[model samples]
Target: SQKIEQNSEALNIQEGKTATLTCNYTNYSPAYLQWYRQDPGRGPVFLLLIRENEKEKRKERLKVTFDTTLKQSLFHITASQPADSATYLCALATFIQAGTALIFGKGTTLSVSS
Candidate 1:
């Protein structure tokens, strides 16, 4: 069986520092991986997507690295601030009825203290 796990607790960090989070999984090789950010009571917004053939992907203050051998993904936010506080989700692509759906882990809440 395939499984994905993200940090179930919140991560608190001071403003202007880099925030790092982890996503671990087992038993499957996905076609791609995606990261999303969700604010309170809202749907997650897509951030980055990395294919299995890729090593890393980045956007603005965010960077993501995927390691298929270890079946893990690392997400980072540099120069973080209070406005950056949100829950980050990691999802892997799974095929369903000729379309793709993301298999998401429970998400890690990040609180950036100013």
Candidate 2:
């Protein structure tokens, strides 16, 4: 079976700073990984996805890196603002006989302060 883990503690950062989050997995190979942001009451919103063949991907102020060797993915938010505060989730997809299986981490909550 595969397992995913993220920071158990909440991440605190200041506005205008860069925030880095980590996602680690074990015992499985994923074809791609995705990041999502979930507010208190809203569903998760897709942020980024990086394929196994890709080393890094970026969009606007967000960046994601996939390292198959390390079985890890790093998520970064540059020029973070208080509005960016939310629970960030890490998910991985693997193709199976039935379909694609998506596994999600517990997520790391981020709080940006002025």
Q: State TM-scores per candidate.
A: 0.91, 0.93
- Native-structure RMSD, model 1: 1.7
Model 2 bad stretches (over 4 Å): 94-97
In candidate 1, how many clashes are counted? 0
Q: lDDT by residue for model 1 over 1-114, one digit each (tens)?
A: 468899566899999999999998886778789999999999999999998899999899999999999899999999999999999999997667878776898999999998
Q: Go through the candidates in order and give each one's C-alpha lDDT.
A: 0.90, 0.92
TM-score of model 2 vs. true structure = 0.93
* Clashing residue pairs, backbone N/CA/C < 3 A, model 2: none
Error of 2 at 13 (Å): 0.6
Give candidate 2's error at residue 86 in angstroms: 0.3
Q: Model 2 has how many clashing residue pairs?
A: 0
TM-score for candidate 1: 0.91
User: For residues 1-114, could you state the per-residue lDDT of candidate 2 as single tens digits?
Assistant: 678999665999999999999999996669889999999999999999899999999999999999999999999999999999999999987556798788799999999999
Pick by TM-score: which candidate is best?
Answer: 2
